[model samples]
Target: MHKSDYIVKYLANSTSDYVTSAQLGDFLSSSTRTVLRYIREIQAESNEHGFEIISNKGQGYRLIIRDKAAFQNYLSNSLAEHEKSDLNKLECQIARQLLLTDYIKLDDLAQQFNYSRSSISRITSAVASIFEGYNLELESKAHQGFSVQGSEINIRHCINNLIFNSFTMYQTARMLQVDDLDWNSFKKAATDIVKSRGLNFKQELLIQFMKYCYIAVNRIRNKRYVNFEQIKDLEFDIVSDESLTLMLELIQLICPEFEKTTESQWELYYLALAWEQSIYPVEKLHDPNPERIKFFLDIVEKAVENIKNYYGIDFTKDHQFLKDLAEHISICYWKYLLNVESENLYLDEVRSKYPTAYYYSVEIAACINESTKTKIPDDELSLITLHFAAKIERENRKQIKTIILCSTEFGITELLKSRLNKQYGDIDVIGICTCDNKVQLCHDNADFYISADQIEQSELNGKPILQLSPFLDEEDCHLLDEFIARLNTTVPLQSICEPNHFYILNKPAKKAHLLNYLCDYLLQEGRITEKEKADIFAREALVPTAIAPHVAMPHCIIQGSSFLVFAVLPKSIIWDQTRINLIILGCFHEGDNQIKNLLKQLYTVISNKQQVDKIIGCKSYDEFIKVMNDFVGEELC
Candidate 1:
């Protein structure tokens, strides 16, 4: 390992406030003169990179890189060339470990690798060389050992650089072997590089380069390559020649390092890129205006061409596909800007075929959203409404069916009704009664009443009523509109379980266990299967199945899963260290449009804590089921 790399590692591992030169010399097991020489070299490099290296004379050095863009530029320039091959290998090892973890200790690392402390110290010095320009200091204090001293941003950059360089080194390690290499030593070396340099900048650059390689290689790897013409209509800029050359060099260098596991590593890298892109789209260079869109499409087309030239992946030049991809990319861009979910069926499908392109597309979209002020379209608003409705319906089903008691006159009531209808057209209005005759018209049937005037009766005989007059003055309509505008608009397809099939579980014990038990029972009865279980598990992983404290509803959309199974756990059990006492397992077959309604009914029963408590106290399974069926109605299942 390079001496500079070793110094960097040692400093990063040491989290002390300061490390004296004497201590650093001791840590390196070298003379004070040799340690001073290494420090001077690091300082020189730091100066060249436009960052200051603080020397406390007796106390050791610190690096500080304040400007992120400048730091990134410094990192890019630093890693642009691989000067010392052996140092690079050590650097790669250190980088990989840093990416995986936050910090490392020098002594622990030395012991793990069966190396002398001095050897680890040497590696740390070498790693520190890469972080020269970032105004960072490597400090070591009694008990603390060594650490990097600089701006948090600079420290992050150093870590990223270490990882990027380490990745490069890992790929090229086998070709150039230095004896006495171990995982601990390698990891320590990498960690040092990250501490001295920066990890975030390096990682971003590496990702960019890897994406370039992935696109190029995939095109040629497969038999059916996408034709450039097919993707010509899509827009995105091809990376510059200089950038491509750098990527090519990196690939060639690293290819030999992981020769045996090249394919797997490549696959993993691609998967990571795909996942990240699906979640967060790339930031585009230009805004999402018409001209900018055209420019983006051109860039994409150019990228597609480059992919064809480098790799043999066949890209369709279909205008519609490109257009759609661009639109999806745009959506992804906005989603990232809005901090929302971007990857769905569209991006997922694209990833299956053109993973690289899909990532680029999403990233471009994200950039567009960030750069431009795109107005939310009517369709987007509608989509948001549906998403909002889904959440509302999920949280409070009683609110789904409301009675709007307004005066029969066309002034306020008609205006209010029109506004309500516009916002919640999907909401079921059982009856729209005039204010004067609201008491006479269907008292027992209404779910809730929204009225302008306050009723004197206590809860209207225990029925829930929302008095909007106090909250909704003239100015409140605008506020309400704004709130509604912010609502999620994605519409979910109607579900399959009927209202009668819905069952509520109110008990708090063994929530997940009881759900699983009921699912197992249903499976035994030929109501569900392994596939259904798998599907349910997948959804649960994305978001917790526990909708409320001490409660969980595990359900799946599967064929032959028709009945809603309700299981009550009388005593709570520790699930994932949380007390869960209630489990509601709703199983549904394909083509069940009433599933949404069932969910609504279940939501209503659970939302009422009093009702839930009463239900939980029931002794027999039959009695429990009876209460659920009574709430949901018996005929619909």
Candidate 2:
């Protein structure tokens, strides 16, 4: 979200409380100083947007809505733009241009897009990551603009994935606007050929093969072809004579230049590989490559073992789950080899519905990448999460729906909700209800009530309330454990890492040395095995977790209960090409069986850089906990 929009939304949700710069900074995950600057910028134009930010003397700042409709409209538009930005429209436009030709002159693109030369330059850089995964590089030339240089095989695979898989064939064709091709005729001929040849083509990917066949025809006509030398490492049994003959016939439909000759062998292999991949089992004539399957299966098995070692959950016992995971991993590996990607239509749904499974899939992705040196795209990860989601659903645990009854104090209600949600993921905090909405919102919504005061008989509605302080005490917390039906203890940070795991590094240290200290300590205590320690380092090697400004969170899942080992450097340290002042080594012990509460616990602390700075400022354990207690922040009864 835009800085101003986030600040405004946070203040709007804050109710009557006047949020301080400290609180706003924490909410924005920025330093209080940065928040103050943001507040100045927002306030400068606040009146125009129909809201007034009232800065009170002792209390922080409160948003006063002068025009509700206008404010809501502005907020909605800002968030809509934010959500669309991870992959923006203009970036996609430029990517399509790259697919159409070898190079695009920035000067020409600037005139065509009606954007400034600098804007066009910035956009092409943004779209570079899309091709990076396919091992393609965008090289700028003095006069030629920029050229996308890569293997022809990778180029074809990248084009097929982007055009067809990401969008509908109809939408893709319009986006590309390739002038002379007949979409309907091409589709018909391709479908007819597949039907006549009796190839078991995947319905979703059949069109992709056809599109690639079109690329092959165009490229060969331009005197470009896949030479044998480029594919020296290609390994796969040849398709049956019948399949090769069919492949030849399929290519000859449009390009008679393609021939059954020694020179054309590799070109034929290129088309056959694309065709076989489009086929459901890869090849009907040969069993799926046993070595390739085993290679990925080994990595999956090891990752599964790592999960068991770390989270204490065993997927090995569930034969079907392992089998399913292995099969999906094999398919994903196949896509990786071919530089192709598939769309996960249910990615967002899977993330919201089975968040825990989605996180587990993240670990699996990292493990696979470390072993195989390949990135597993989110779409593929979501599919893997479904496999984990199946196991998650089988457990069939009931979630405890909760409603927090508290006053609209500056930070009281927020503190309570964060505590409850982080303590147990299944304990859903439906919403915080005040004296006004308590009777109405609580009646049908809450399974139980967490209140700071006794409920009057008239407002009781026969529901039990756990009367407790805003800062939850041990006895009331124990009662909560029993009330919520969870057997796990509510482990506070003090109990987990306050005294021993916490560190204030006085001397300068490299990122590697620093992490080694944390891992070595865990290893010495036998809290984490040597292999698990190696897993953490291996993960860091594959992907750097550093963010710009001043924050770095190097985290991993582990066996036993979750705990954190935190450290603060006296000065800035260069970590994986970024400088950071604070480091949080989060060892999450998610059982993965129940809803994951630990993730909720860590998210509030690490969600922003300013939050990390605030954490680093605390010199003592008591101050740290006190500051964090408020970070979950606010409520009362």
The TM-score measured for candidate 2 stands at 0.49
> How much does candidate 1 score in TM-score?
0.37
Q: How many backbone clashes does candidate 1 have?
A: 104
Candidate 2: worst-modelled 10 consecutive residues by lDDT: 628-637
Task: List model 1 lDDT by residue over 122-191, tens digit each.
Answer: 8766555433333355555566555555443334334334432333544423222221234344334434
Best by TM-score: 2
RMSD of each: 19.8, 13.9
**Residue ranges of candidate 1 with Cα displaced over 4 Å:** 1-257, 260-281, 285-516, 529-544, 547-550, 558-561, 569-580, 604-637
lDDT of 1: 0.44
TM-score of each model, paired residue for residue: 0.37, 0.49
Give me the candidate number with maximum lDDT. Answer: 2
Q: Write the per-residue lDDT of candidate 2 for residues 1-637, one digit (tens) a residue.
A: 5656778888889765778875665454333434654675677678888899877766778899999888888887888778644436667667777777766799888898889999888888767765664556778888787887877776766665555545565565555453245556656776887788676666668765767766676666655676544233334343345556667877776565566666666677667767776753634423456755666566677777767765566776776677667766765564544444453434445654564576567678877776665566445667788989888767645477767776666278677777766565567777777766745764566666778655663234565676766667677775665444322325555655657777888788767788998899888887788877887887665444552245676776677666677787768876643457877776766554322554434543454345677877889766777766565431100
lDDT of 1 at 180: 22
